[model samples]
Target: MSAPYAIPRSHADWRAMAESQSFETRAFIDDAFVDAASGETFETINPATGKVLARVASCDAADAEVAVHHARAAFDRGDWSRIAPGRRKKLLLRLADLMETHKHELALLDTLDMGKPVSSSLGDMAGAIACLRYNAESIDKVYGEVAPTGEDSLGLVLREPLGVVASIVPWNFPLMMTAWKIAPALAAGNSVILKPSEKSPLSALRLAQLAKEAGLPQGVFQVLPGFGHTVGKALALSMDVNCLAFTGSTAVGKQLMQYAGQSNLKRVYLECGGKSPNIVFADCKDLDAVAENAAAAIFHNQGEVCIAGSRLLVENAIREDFIERVLKAAEGMQPGDPLNPDSFMGAIVDQTQYQRILGYIRQGVEEGAHLRSGGESVETCPGGLFISPTIFDNVTPEMVIGREEVFGPVLSVFGFDTEEEAIRMANDSLYGLAAGLWSQDIDRIMRVTRRLESGQVYVNNWAGGDMTVPFGGVKQSGNGRDKSMHSLQEYSELKTVWMSLTS
Candidate 1:
């Protein structure tokens, strides 16, 4: 079937439609959009067009206190946190349905706010809706444990909601990341306060309106839009916030952890940055497929994904041929207007990200890595933040481009001689969020899968999965899982119940 909404074709059309759409810019509290306590505001711009979308309230520590107080009151008063699990599931399902109904609007907002391709944003919206619905359906199915005891005693375990949750999402996948955290938390019967990245906050505010329409109670879900250092730190340090979930850089994640310990000792769940490795063995059935997946992995969302396969590790025998094919595939991906459906790549989130990516490219040059494909920004599209797909070959494990998370359309290729060496190279990084392996040999694939230290591994493909599988990472990539039943446990607390009777 065709998509419900047609993609905007021209820059003029996009600007006309986007400028006419009214958006709310205040902090969401008690089921309403309101300004921050300090009345401070910041401008939200459309990265694709560089136009001001709205003036969002700049929430500070005081605004966070208000939001958290309302959330705590809602939780303690049994409005949401103390509700029946089944009812909470129903509400979550309704919320998902509402999101699905407005998928096109959310997709447009996402593209305008974050400068991702509209078609990709549409798909992400659908995935986010499905994720929420799936989590809601699973809420009532998760069961607690019953411990076996002596004949005279009985022990029962119950799962209860963790009171108030604070979620901080990144700019790359704004609405989807929000749903990733919001769905499970709400389904588990917890009231939440969300803080979206300052770079992109439009979709998050729109989500607040959708949540309200889904019949979520006042104070059950709140959104505070502002700089991370101000409002985000407040959420991290708030004693009333029982749990915190964040997706961003490792440096900020460490700061959040420290803040959690300093104030509340809250449970912090982080899905930090990653420099994922996509390994291609010489025995792969199709080099063309490997190259295609390689391009999509790095080029998708302009390479802002935390799990993007930025590090391409190929077998020494196929290094030359594979690089040629990958370069050919990358030529087809051109960064342009995000609103155009034909455009596979789009702008960076903002000017800061654009400059950051440029700086990294310059670093790759300075560090002596061979720039094989693209390494410069496009000057024709001056208004939009555009960077060509960059590939660095002959990259050692020690180079900055090979080690750090560039978070742009940058790929570093490293050649390995043997299976053991390939596995060693893949597991050498501190971040092990996700990895991919391309090979036709069953034995070698099995051996590599068992030895790889990543949390999620894709075999012969780029990205695939839904709410059925657990999504998380090992080591410095962060703790706790999202999606599936495993994610539900993060928002729930266990309680032991014992009963004895003598009649």
Candidate 2:
């Protein structure tokens, strides 16, 4: 049965109803939600309406140590790690079922905490469920290998799970990202200590409860909600943590790598930032579709995606027409309360991010780029963190707005005269997370796909994929993949067994 809170209505109705709702205090540890050790708490505000949704526990390094100790004890005792693979798989599948049952509540919590539109949060919740299920289904299927050897000798390769994993998930798509890391880690027989982003920790806390209800053993899945400087640093530096996975900015990813090296030399997997390119060729069949997709690519989730196609590389022949269409589409993107299912774009994550995006917009104009559509901050609601959908034409590849990740609804479009120039410009960024190509010609598609230096490439679309496909990046965009059987391998180590009959 669907959750009672899951209502069917237009975006407008959802927005109006959600604005009046109040949330409870949040903290999850050892299979229960509790207050911080220091008795300190913080408020999580809705950026769309600037209202406090929940008061969450504010933890520090001391709390992190407690969480880690529990995780280490659980792993050392082998309650989860020594469980049969088939049994572990069943537990994971049960968790997935529970997530489906409470989809509406989880989706609503996500929207209220992160300020993403309810529709988008619903989709994200669905994706998170799929991720957990996919990993669960693959748990028992992964097999060790036996290498061919001479007579009277045997050799076998085995995969073993790391003891305890520390997962640091970003604010954008908080629950989904956490599942991307935790599902596979747990399926592969590891205990996890998750540190959700301070900006949005409600869903993670709720997820801990759901996991417990779904039969996850105590300490097998623990959540430590706190600021990154203390709790995050503590997790990274803890010698007991066998593996560390993170999804955030490139700058922070580098820092985590350094911390990992300094501590236990633990295996680190990072999925970092990107300034992805969405290249549109003149030979594309539909300019209107390209323009619409371009707008959606940058504006979806308020442009908070690590793999957002913020850099638009267009052919000079149809550049003016394409920009006009893109601007028209941008104007139609209504930014309002996130609980509204009708609003495609919601508020920025917080006031700081709102001002940061505005600063970038102003910098683009000061750097001589043309403001094609929207740039200034929206004054609606007076306190909510909202920015108008912004598009910049006449932008160069070297502009700050073009190169750096604004992490808001900002698009920078650059024109190139030839295909060679277009590909060159598209590949001219330190980030190589994702890129898109719009072309009908088979040869052009193949050639561009081969030349473009990105981890994931899409043709005539943006951000559509199943859990089987790998997701990661190269260069400064960071290393490692998530959301596949490959992701489970990241949490495991390989061992070889050799036997000799000569003895």
Candidate 3:
């Protein structure tokens, strides 16, 4: 669309790169790519240019059954599931190594499948590698517990792998989210069935090939790409799956929980939606830095991040000045060709999401929120679904745009009178995934950090830090954590073993 910076690479370069290799389409099951049981395939479109990338296998309930059965059989045989923790770690590390070696290609595929800049996709690839390596390295260090007991008796607490795990990840950050679930699950020595969103299934399919190249056993890891109403529901309803780990909408998470209950009552771990708050005080110093970060938090990845700081809670004393700073910061982030490394943002993922984001903007205007900056279409990118970064000021907590998850580059500004009021407004939302606090006062930082209802809190910056820390949400944002040692427990089942020592 509109790129503020001069193109670092030509459009012809992208065409050449895209023509160099073919993206995978078939489902990977039982250690190989295969047709779906129904023999149907769906076309996965390139969001950046609106071209069909590949015909991904359209797996449904029947294919899900086939995958689950194979997984169950694999788990039952104990070929991989009963392997030593060190051995599994070794295999996973090898997979991580392979991922890093092919990083550029993986990054390109991700950018092509979903409308995100190549630079951003590379970061996602790096994050995925980090997640896998971290999980792989931690398994051998973690140990089962020896409980205290009388001298005559002994108590042992053993951590055992769940037999079969179904991992459902969202379209945004596909590879990274997949690794978040698969790495820990594999480290725990369980069979995994990965269900990537149909909209962006290319990278997951390619990763399955790499997993095989790394020598993961047959039926140990499988990828089924399909619509949620069909294969996703099938996985949820299956009685054989021991656990279901998901990252997506709060509504879908709730529905999956219900399905889990209706079936085997499998353990459900969810990392869902958020309208995370970024609170800035009339700080002692640096409004410029805070303003810059505030804009980036919502504009990055076209605001697809579940923990994006969509709601900006600014102190009343500095609200007007901060909004101007934020507007200036947003000017450089225009929608452009995702293939270019210099591009800050790209097109929307698809028409459905494109329309949804515009609808939310319309809702904001109707509710009387003042349009602050770019909210119009990017006419330069005709075929692509490109939108300029949109910001709304004078937003109340009760407005539709203020309450809902727009999942686009849309920011809502809310002014607060005091520290207590800022905290109150930040905690008012049902979602509690993440939040940020900015202040020079150490006392205010400590107090607000302690009082915040979020699962993860960032001080002085928005979404700071890395994969080593735990991530997830509380309340309506969903249950359980991801991306740390805590995630390992999600795929494991603890058994307390008691034995008598007789003389």
**Cand. 3 TM to true fold:** 0.97
lDDT accuracy of residue 363 in candidate 3: 90
Q: Backbone collision count in every prediction? A: 0, 2, 0
Off by over 4 Å in 2: 1-26, 380-382
Highest-lDDT candidate = 3
Alpha-carbon shift of residue 201 in model 2 (angstroms) = 0.5
Q: Give, for candidate 3, the lowest lDDT window spanning 10 residues.
A: 1-10
Q: Clashing residue pairs, candidate 2?
A: 11-341, 11-342
After aligning candidate 1 to the native by TM-score, how far in Å is the CA of 251 from where it should be? Answer: 0.6
Q: Candidates' lDDT values, in order?
A: 0.89, 0.88, 0.90
Structural similarity to truth (TM-score) of each candidate: 0.96, 0.97, 0.97
lDDT of 3 by residue, 163-264 (tens): 999999998898999999999999988999999999899999999999999999899999999999999999999999999999999999999999999999
TM-score of 1: 0.96
The regions of model 1 sitting more than 4 angstroms off are: 1-16
Which pairs of residues collide in model 1? none
lDDT of 2 by residue, 349-445 (tens): 9888888898999999999999878897776555778788899999997789988999999999999998899888999999999999999888999
